[model samples]
Target: MFSFFESQRLLFYYLGFLAFALAVLTKGIAGLFFGPVILIYALINKKLIGLLKNPHTYISFLGMAVLVLGYYFGREALNPGYLEIVSFNELGGRFEENLGSKKFGYWYHLEGFKNYRFAPWLLLALLALPLAYYSKDDKLRKLTTLSTLAVLVHFFVISSSSTKQPWYDLPMYPFLAMLASIPLWILYSALQKVNLYSFALSGKIIAFLLLVVVFRAPYQEVWDATYKPSEPPWNYETMGSEHFLFNVLYGKDNLDKAKVLHLGNNDHLRFYKKVLAQKGIEVELIEPENLQSGDVIVTCQAEIQSLLNENYRLELLNDSSVYRKYRILSANRKSPIDHR
Candidate 1:
């Protein structure tokens, strides 16, 4: 499994840096998703399918997969900057985020902090437990159970964000998917030797999972958010090639510019600005305190008024909060804050 680990090393570093930076800056452990990300890193490097064939190859492949997949998945698209726009504009709603993380790590936060949005992640992790414990293959069982618990805890904790930002859970998805895949692969391998009854059952179960993965609802927001280049098409500058968030939102191009205040890694807002600048529109990256009326200030629900001057009006943009209050609010300069 040295090869697997070899591949995941970069991923680990990339995610590690991201988690550390986010934790320090956000004053929260929204970075907890990194643990699952690491677990997935271990699995991918080891090469799940290959390791299953020969337990000896397990460790190496696990390492490799984690590295490979982690590198691939650890893009800026998964960060809070893109996630906020993407979550509201596309993908699942804020119901799944753990608010507790807003104040601290998910577990350390208050009660009922985590809400909806557990798309079989917890179930799959839990299911893998018994399989790993009972597996005929000792090596696989240990890895499976270990990985399963990692993902389960990751999901349970990260989901508690009082402020549910989509990217907060980004680190866990790859690990969750990989962890779930292992048990099925093991089950199939085992059933191949057993009678057709169990084999058929395994087949059915695997097929069902395939359906869940494949047929899940599309992120219409993203598809609809796609737009082509023009005299900057619309007026504002949109950085970043291919709207990761936009794609998840409209499922196509909406072709509009957001005067966003981005607070993320590598200055995510700044990252997008470079690209949009190419298109002739320089996007502004401001902090909440820099928030101004009439300007579309994009930030977490909690941070909205943190930068607000109270002179402008709050319009509904998106609401992914624990209380499910105002998620994405717009401060309109047209009307008085008190009047509206």
Candidate 2:
């Protein structure tokens, strides 16, 4: 949308403003990247002077401010203490989560790029940086520079945080794809000049095959090994050791806006909290000793027998080898606590 505005599309400028506002509503601080992306785009286009004078640019900033305040106040209205919880969870809680985990902070992405996971796709995109830097075409050079700079800016900002996750970088994917396509088309055009049909077709086929080998094969292998027929919604046991129950509770269960009594450690608890929130359901983590009647227990496989012995009618919700989800059918049903 910012690109559209840069190209003098007035309608898209407003649309982009609305789009970024919606993004802010959905993802909070994550959606604020458009401000920097637009600044970088204007800088690359040498229109920073005009940028300062543009009424539409100021409107964009106004729209963003409105969105930020509206989202903050709206959450406060909804829960009163929501922002306090958000601050603690987003900052202190997240920092604690990263204490011992060694999954690269913000630089994990660089490792993926360097490892050639996507090979020519990644390599081609990277090659565009230098090509764009040295290109004679003004428009192409500015756009590519904007893409590169936007990605770098996003990376630098996100990396400053102690916590990093794969999904956090989604905003950067489009720019990376844009960068990769530059060299890709350049190579195709070069091949076209060398051999209009024969070599071009062969090169295309080879490139396609290489992508299949480098990118698709590993993903397909993992999918085939984990996917299950009975569990139509989710692949069993593939969602981490602690997430199996979480997956079934949020994925397969049909209870409308159901509340979940989670009997487990706090590991991956936030993910389930978010998922349940989307479903308009509440999730509470409770101790095993505090178990009550009619309270469904979501726990690892080892706890199933103990739950059964406590006279809770066990309805197996998930039965994967790694983890399980079970429901306690009757609060009134009484039997031996250790019949198992």
Candidate 3:
């Protein structure tokens, strides 16, 4: 995008359109903001008329349409109603109603900046905006305008939607980082003007130290999140147990022939099913009454005791905090020893 802004070559325009199409393909309609952002920037800079007169712009748009719409057309051809399902379930449904009860106010993303992850850079970005806007440099002003537009456009669009996730705010970070660099650059330039050798050296040292101070918190956050993640507050042991169970069964003998029954409500059942399917394993949801000899049951702790009370002899295979894996040794028969 920066390259396109610097050079209005037809090749750059094509590359930009291709990139826009790829972004949309990768993340769905969230990527459509690219067009509106560029259009708005051109209008703000009084370049709309010029862009309209440029023939290559239309050619680029046509190419992008073929690339993006072709995929949608092929998908719809293969599975009729695919686009309709996506329109309702993945696109418009998110805006019209809260899916999965993930409702949050419009200020959710805006408030997220106050969190530890973004707070440090966000402050610098905010301070840099005014300085960048009033600067005499033409290129700096344009870059700042573009970054600001991208941030605002993406922020409002996602924030207004009923369905929200933390990752939805990811697209805004690059632009915010771009904006944040302006203030750092200004400080570096100011420090370079110190007249005395000692003062200049001291100023450079101070600037370097300030840069380190500003980056320390976010860097540590990245390190901890990647290498030494702390446990989430929510109870995720059941889900973790499912993953552990799958890992244990992944290479076991006759896994493909095993009748695996998942009991109780598990929200990620579909995802886990797909993952297991790739490993030649099939899992089904079954009730406690459906227990049969030789059947394997993956259930939570709440259901284990009741199965045992029903006179089903279950052999414990593995256990996690809230989930258990068991094989039915005998169904509708009492065992001499308590299995629980």
Specify the highest-TM-score model's number.
3
Task: Go through the candidates in order and give the clash count of each.
Answer: 67, 1, 0
Q: Candidate 2 vs candidate 3: which has greater lDDT?
A: 3
lDDT of 2: 0.64
Instruction: Please list the C-alpha lDDT of all candidates, in the order they appear.
Output: 0.47, 0.64, 0.73
Error of 3 at 337 (Å): 22
Give, for candidate 1, the lowest lDDT window spanning 10 residues: 319-328
C-alpha lDDT (0 to 100) for residue 83 of candidate 1: 37
- The parts of candidate 3 lying over 4 Å away from their true place are 195-203, 235-239, 242-340
| Residue 134's lDDT in candidate 2 | 77
Q: Please report, as a residue range, the 10-residue window in candidate 2 with the lowest summed lDDT.
A: 229-238
106-213 per-residue lDDT for model 3 (tens digits): 888888876854786778888877998788888988988899989999988888888888788899889998999998888877865655655648777777777798
User: RMSD of model 1, in Å?
Assistant: 14.5
For residues 1-340, write the lDDT of model 1, one tens digit per residue.
2223445354454454444444533432343344454555457556555434644444444554565445434643466365355444223344344333344445532222234344444555557767777777766665665555555666665454345444555555565566666666765565445445546566556655655554354344234455532223231223232232333243342224445543344354455566656656555555554454455544432333443435444665543321111223455455433311
Output the lDDT of residue 115, model 1.
Answer: 41
lDDT of 2 at 108: 79
**Winner on lDDT (1 vs 2):** 2
